[model samples]
Target: MSSSTVSRNSLEADQQWLLRSSSPENDLDRDERPSKPRRHIVAVLCLVLMFTVAGYVTSSVLLNNRLEHPFRIPKLPHEEPCDFAPSRPSWNSMPRHRRHAFISAVQRLASKPSRLGLSNTSMYDDFVYVHTKVVWQVHHHAISLPFHRYFVHIFEQALQNDGGYDGLMPYWDWTQDSSDPLASIVWDPWAGFGSAGNGCISDGVFARVGKFANYTENGYEPHCVTRNCLAHADAVDESDGVMHSKHWTPAIVKAIIDDSTTYRDFRQRLEEGPHKHLHAYGIGGDMASASSPNGQFIPQPKHTLSRIP
Candidate 1:
């Protein structure tokens, strides 16, 4: 073979070898470039997933804490009742300003919308609704007195917390002025619970304030608090030979207190006696219905912190 031809063939063979090596290098570069991007994408996805899990865990923990320890207002030192002082007093014995303050608080609560829902017009309506709903379960049962006592407590709390009342709730001691209940001091037109009118109350602090929003007879209507005084005559013993008008007198209350030995006995006598009579005479309209307006006037047991115990 000629030397030039041999050299040319050798050069061509070298070129082919170089081309093959270059092709492999290009393929490796392309494959490696795509693999780097894939690795980067996987790392980013892992980071995003990790953050999502961390956030979920944090929120769950916070929610559980919130549920476990619900928010509440701490009681102040002054809220505790003094040992020597009376916690509740008769309505007639309450200070004039305190009575007015309570009345004003009730009016304020009556004006505010119910927290239960918008369907209920006012806070007073919510109370009436609750009474109506639970009337069957609470009345004429062992739980009656306890239920009513708790209910009154809740009402007093609302008066303080929501209505901004400062005085403790006062109860009407019907026996104190039972001789002439209609002319009782608590029925004064200027400063008391107001006197009975035709169908609705027309005098005193609660007069034509028109705030009660619900009633069994009339639902979701604006109306004033109502009262009606009914008088009854009781026949005397044959030896006495004279009949006289009767009222829920202190003597009856004394008898009940003296006669009652057990809680059930006390409840039965009180319920069947002065309690029933007061409801029959004191309230009219829906207040006199089977579902009583004043939760059947469950009397607090003598000398106790709570009406139930």
Candidate 2:
């Protein structure tokens, strides 16, 4: 063998060795080896992503259901629809017979004994007692109009249930009589609330009763339903600093109705403005008192009955 032939044989051997070292089996052994920790981390990440998606879907479904059926209250099976709405007529518009019936009912209520365990001697006194008790809270607050509205309602219920009065509550439209309150037809002896007398009311349906219950300066005591309707300029000036008779006018009422946006504003305007004015001038006796007299011409009823219903 020559030297050149020996050298060629050695190069061929080196080439064969290089091919074996770079084989697919060797690469597979190095690169395709499975790592247990990496496999566990990938599996955990996949599970977490699946659970997160499922949880989001479930929450969205539940929220939609809640929004669709927010209120779970059950409807009554035997509920009857109310069809009748009682008409609240003005005092002047009310029929004479109905007026008489209302007066009779009020008298009956006044005559009955008080259910409230206060020093109240009669049902009328019970009303006075309640008014006096909660006057401070209910007068100037947001609840003033609503409180009075309900108060009138309870009284009406009493008249209906106890006194057998079927007629609706009669509201005194003081706007009509604001100009000449004393000469108003409501004070008529025959057809309306009787005119004011010396101390106790000497006329009208309220008159001729022996005594009124829970009427006193200090405490509850039996007394007559009294009035001092004679207007004193000095006293009037002192109370409000004006002698002019202030009552609800259509313009004033319209302004209040139109301007007042919130319930609080509406209530404050009404309770402070028209209501106070009427009470000050209308039946100035027990009507003005903190613990006012039970009997009057008519319980100055509200014209609009919005708050009652």
Candidate 3:
């Protein structure tokens, strides 16, 4: 009786072990089931985490761009031929207070740190940095006019957004003083650009600009606003006078406008004739070089917005 009972008990125990929850035979299937599901869950979690991080980064960049440039708003499809201001008024038309404001804005810009990190100079020198680097690339090509137009446009934007200048950039119509540029109001001491002495400009608001950055060769060099106004100096050209190009008379500029039929012809003539001549003419100061904006004779653009990309 005891042998039969013991044999039955052993058989029951073996069956119970086979059906146990932690048995190796059942564990094979359990392991296979969860392996694929766990792998899928981990991959999905990784993807979700990656997407979350990317979304946060993209949103942050967009927020920063909006904060930095509030004026840069996307135009709607219906907003065609956007025109805010019809005409650009010259500095002569600007009131005395506004003129002073422009000067103050420029001074404020010069006080700020350089954004380009190209030199220790102020933000104003950033234009000099760009203009100097792209001088050859922009100049002597069809892109010259548009490139310079871009310069004035960007510069004006910096002045407005950064320097807090509300007035439209001023354009100098130098043709008025083609006869005697030295006597021009553009060089007035108090309200206008102060005169020069000993070859370097010692007066005017721009007198603080004692250094300029040349990105092409040197980073920054100590320089001053100087004009080539040497009527009778040592080691000079006889043909050259107080001004560089006497050929840039009003008649010639008119001929370039009136005679040119094609766009290329017009641009070419304007760039070569009036443009180059004006730069090389009466006030051949820093305005004649890539560091033109750093000087008193800042060339303002009329229809430069159209040229910008």
TM-score of each: 0.62, 0.65, 0.64
* 1-309 per-residue lDDT for model 2 (tens digits): 764454344333333433443345422223222244533443333222222311222434443434221122113233588687666777877778888888888778776776554444766566666665544444454434554665566667677766778976677776666556567667777678676533566676556666754655356667766554544222344333322255456666767788989766776577556665555443445555555535443556343423223
Q: Supply the global lDDT for candidate 3.
A: 0.50
- Which scores higher on TM-score, 1 or 3? 3
RMSD (Å) of each candidate, 1 decimal: 35.8, 38.3, 31.0
Report the lDDT tens digits of candidate 3 across residue range 59-84.
44443434222122222224366667
lDDT per residue as tens, model 1, 94-206: 77887788778877877788656646576655666556554534444344565566556666666777678887767776666655545666657766766543345567756
Clashing pairs in 1: none
Off by over 4 Å in 2: 1-82, 118-120, 232-244, 301-309
lDDT of each: 0.49, 0.53, 0.50
Extract clashing residue pairs from model 2.
Answer: none
User: Best candidate, lDDT-wise?
Assistant: 2
